[model samples]
Target: MAGDRDWWFDEAAGPLIRPYAMTRGRTRPGAPNLNLVTQIRASRNRSDLSQLTPEHQEIVDLCERPLSVAEIAAYLNIPLVVAKILISDLLELGDVVAGAPFQTSDIVDTKFLQAVLDGIRRI
Candidate 1:
């Protein structure tokens, strides 16, 4: 019986809560501009912490140093849509502020990336 139940709650399995449950089944973010490059940061007003779920609070903490929507999703190990929904909730509550998407210069620079890769190879 123990072996039969082991697969159900394996050590490799993640959180018990379904991803949809965290967003209350919301697949889309209320704010439409939350793209992968959009930057998020915690706001000065954190008085509404009690109103936030644990996932939302985690986003707030992660955003303290200004993180991208994609980064937040990666850090939380959740889907991008799920992270966006959580961020949307915090936005509505004034817990976090969203910044403009990361912009790139007209000219591309592959040299910097190549240098870093070479340094890693050397190590």
Candidate 2:
């Protein structure tokens, strides 16, 4: 019951639950609304949270401040796929709002040519 490879067991003959099992081995997100950079914020309709497992609840609590799937995964120390699946559940249940994928828009440097020239002269 407490071994490294053990599964969750309630009864001696009860069905075993794996650690990584998500929505019964589901590989697809319910809404397909998430990406690495997609931002998620908690919604007002957390009524669905009552039916969630602890892991799901943790996700909701963490998203009180908007966060991305990758961040969630890192924070929870779980696989990205698992975080995505849980987030998808929250998305389908209307417990979370998914923003468009975040895009980095930093300006490029204008001094690259000067830097290159400096390096060439040093060489």
Off by over 4 Å in 1: 1-11, 102-123
In model 1, residue pairs whose N, Cα or C atoms come closer than 3 Å (at least 3 residues apart or on different chains), thus clashing, are none
Q: Across residues 1-123, which tens digit of lDDT does each residue of candidate 2 receive?
A: 134223444546432554357456876667676789898899987765678986688788888998988998887656777788888888878888899754433326548756878999999
Candidate 2's displacement at residue 121, Å, is 22
Looking at model 1, how many pairs of residues clash?
0
Q: What TM-score fits each model?
A: 0.72, 0.64
Evaluate model 2: give its lDDT.
0.75
Give each model's whole-structure lDDT. Answer: 0.83, 0.75
Cα displacement (Å) at residue 2, model 1: 28
Model 1: per-residue lDDT, tens digit, 24-104?
Answer: 988899989999989999999875686777788878988889899999998877889999999998888889999986555
Error of 1 at 71 (Å): 0.6
